[model samples]
Target: MKVLLTYTSMTGRNEKIANYLADYLKEKGADVDLEEIIDTDAFGLTDYDAVIVESYTYHDGEVPDEAQDFYEDLADVDLERTKFAVLGSSSKKHIHFGRAVDYFTMQLNSSNGEQVSDSVKIDQDPDEDDFKRVRDLGDRVLKSLK
Candidate 1:
């Protein structure tokens, strides 16, 4: 399946995690398209069989401005046939930790996209083990496609 992974990272932590995921998926033989949400002009959920939407926790449970554009770009895309999962990279100590994941999941589900896996919430200061878990998330999503 083709997997599109997009994310925004204010402090670069989420970007690192997104890259790790893309690498893992590629190594596993899945077709992967990884891009920073800020760098992409447009995207449609229908273009890929499955997608991984990710972001770092931003202000008070709000989606970052960069990702908002991409999400809005999805407006013209038919999502009912798409499967996706969300990943949130945040500091557990932050008041809004994991809020990005919650918001993204809600948006995707409300639009009729299938949720491929439970949202994966990574605490701040992710380590190698956390990286592995995040990579496994990609594997799990791929399995769901089968």
Candidate 2:
């Protein structure tokens, strides 16, 4: 399967998570493309069989400024043939923890992408269990291709 994994990170937490997921997916034999969210084109999603998005929620529950364009552009794209999953690392200290993950999940669904896994919201950094969930999420995305 051809998979695109796009992400944005400020404190490097999300970046670490993105890489871990990418490695996990690659080990499973998926042709994975990893890119920053700013470098990804929402319209280009049609080229991939699946997409996995990871992001850090900005202060007060906002998508990072750099990812705003790609987030908005999803509204214009149709991804009925693509499977998707979203996950993010954000401080649970914030009232709206990991809101960016929620936003991406909803937006992808709205754009007609099949959600292969439930969105994961991690607190601050990932713990062992968090990493396991991330792996399970990747596994689900890959399994969807069958």
Candidate 3:
């Protein structure tokens, strides 16, 4: 399956999670296109069998500035047949932990993408359990494509 994995990582944790998940999906035989969210085209998601988004929440629970264009663009895209999932690594210290993950998940659903897994939100750093959840998210997305 062709999967598009787009992410934004200011502190590297989300980038690491995105890479790990991309590798996990690749090992399972998926054709994965890993890109930075700013470099990705929201209108192009429909070209993939599955799409995954990873991000970091910013001040007051906003999508990072670098990814704002893509986030807003998502509202206009139609993903009726795209299977999707969202995950983020943010500080649990923040009251709105991983809110960007929530925003993306809701927007993708609103765009009509078939959600393949529940969104994942990891605090500051990922531990063993967090990695497992990321893998599980990847597994669900890949499975839904079959």
Candidates 1 and 2, the one with greater TM-score = 2
| Model 1 residue pairs with clashes | none
TM-score-based ranking, best first?
3, 2, 1
The weakest ten consecutive residues by lDDT in model 2 span 79-88
lDDT of 2 by residue, 1-146 (tens): 99999999999998999999999999999999999999999999989999999999998899999999999999999997589999999998889998989999999999999999999999988999999999999999999998
Q: For every model shown, what is its TM-score relative to the native structure? A: 0.89, 0.98, 0.98
* Overall local distance difference test of candidate 1: 0.81
Residue 40 lDDT, candidate 1, scale 0-100: 62
- Cα lDDT for residue 52, candidate 2: 94
- Cα error of candidate 3 at position 143, Å: 0.7
Q: Let me know the TM-score candidate 1 reaches against the reference structure.
A: 0.89
- After TM-score superposition, the amount by which residue 104's alpha carbon in candidate 2 deviates from its true location, in angstroms, is 0.8
What value does the lDDT take at residue 2 in candidate 2?
A: 96
Per residue, candidate 3 scores C-alpha lDDT tens digits across 33-83 of 999999999999999999999999999999999999999999999997689
In candidate 1, position 139 carries an lDDT of: 79
Model 1 ranges with Cα > 4 A deviation: 41-43, 73-77
> Given candidate 1, what's the lDDT at residue 21?
88
- Candidate 1 residue lDDT tens string, 1-146: 79889888888788888888888888888899998877764446678888888887677877888788876766555586588899978877878889878888877876778987889888876888887778778878889878
